[model samples]
Target: MSGQQHILEFRFLAEPTDVNFGGKVHGGAVLKWIDQAAYACAVAWSGKYCVTAAMGGIQFVAPILIGDFVQVRCRLVHTGTSSMNLIVDVRARDLKAVRDRLATQCVLTFVALDAPDGKPTPVPKWIPESEEDMALARYAEKVMEVHRRIDQEVSDLRPAGQDH
Candidate 1:
């Protein structure tokens, strides 16, 4: 889903070190980029340190080959008392073919933290100033709904006698 008006762009070149012997970039490498991009976006929005609280809906749609240039784009999707939701999309550009394709997508949850004590901190409310921005906000709401249901289902499945 689309998110806030501001989109943060992060780019990296995939080298042999980032790839497996099969020539595809490792999933762990992509995940690290996603988290870095998401954290940067959250900090840009909140102007504070942010820590990852959770992540969801990680889907790998395409493979990134060695020598591909990878780009991660992130945007704030939702906000709560001290947390912000970010959606990040990872794409790979084939320098040889000059083609760009989506490789992976994920939703990340981050909480603003006080620098002094690493306590929970508040972030500014996401204000959509245009029609398109408002539409993204609506999409974020829908994503949040799905996240809530999934969380509830997981909670319900836990053994009654065990601590979750």
Candidate 2:
């Protein structure tokens, strides 16, 4: 664990129960892990409970088979008055290999909430220091715009006062 508390990593085994019909870990299962890891990072950085406002560009490059070791790594890349952006990377390692390979990656936006009423609340500012941190922040910014556009497009597809 880093003393700065900017990043967090969680490891889990891809269980048989998580497998899809094709015999690989379900993409939704991996997404759930991503959300959990990002929430952990947001809660740690904001020191408050958080809600996922949006997710950006989840790219599943490789498959995670059952019995493989799954690692979800999350880091705080950017912050606003009440919104926090996190970059989450998922990797999987076979039983025999020590090194993990990238399986999925995405950026997510979370909103810190006041505990009593679950209202939006401000969070501590996160200033990127390292080059990697800066790059990730920039990437998050770009992805956020794309996410917003996609959300708008989806909303346009839905009728007024109706949920999709």
Candidate 3:
């Protein structure tokens, strides 16, 4: 598959079961959707099994209310010899409103693997070709620093052998 072809969009209505007791859709539900969409993209791009290496920058900008239409969009923004960086966005739209608000956003890294031995396998190189693609690529590249900082902060919060 071509690099640009690594895109998948899924639309679903947030049912009552998806919400918490507070009446808002749970963040974990949206995160599961993000992972599902990202996995789809990775599999399509690599034509092989893929595993989630990392998922970061999961910012829940807004709450998704029950009865809202939710859209999960995933697109490949960058790639390495055996890895891929995908931008995943979850948006929510009111049943009666005209605009869809950004509910959640995250970046995921996936590593393609051989099905039989579960070894890392090569994937097609994805080169950003347009301004928007370039911007996404830059964001994918720059977000690593923030992820490292978050990891360090959490590590610092835990004592040497108390890490849980």
Go through the candidates in order and give each one's C-alpha lDDT.
0.83, 0.91, 0.90
> Which residue ranges in model 1 land beyond 4 Å of their true spot?
1-5
| lDDT of each residue in 20-106, candidate 3, tens digit only | 999999888888899999999998998889999888878999999999999999999999999999999999999899999999999
Q: Model 1 over residues 43-161: C-alpha lDDT tens digits?
A: 88888898998777789999998888888999886778788888888999888776799999988888999899999988888766788766766676676678778988988999897
Each model's TM-score? 0.84, 0.92, 0.90
lDDT of model 2 at position 90: 96
What is the C-alpha lDDT profile of model 2 across 35-59, one tens digit per residue? 9999998888888889999999899
Q: By TM-score, who's the top model here? A: 2
Worst 10 residues of 3 by lDDT: 1-10
Q: Which candidate achieves the best lDDT against the true structure? A: 2
Q: Give the TM-score of candidate 2.
A: 0.92
Clashing pairs in model 1, backbone N/Cα/C closer than 3 A = none
Which parts of model 2 are misplaced by more than 4 Å? 1-4, 160-164
Compared to the true structure, candidate 3 yields what TM-score?
A: 0.90
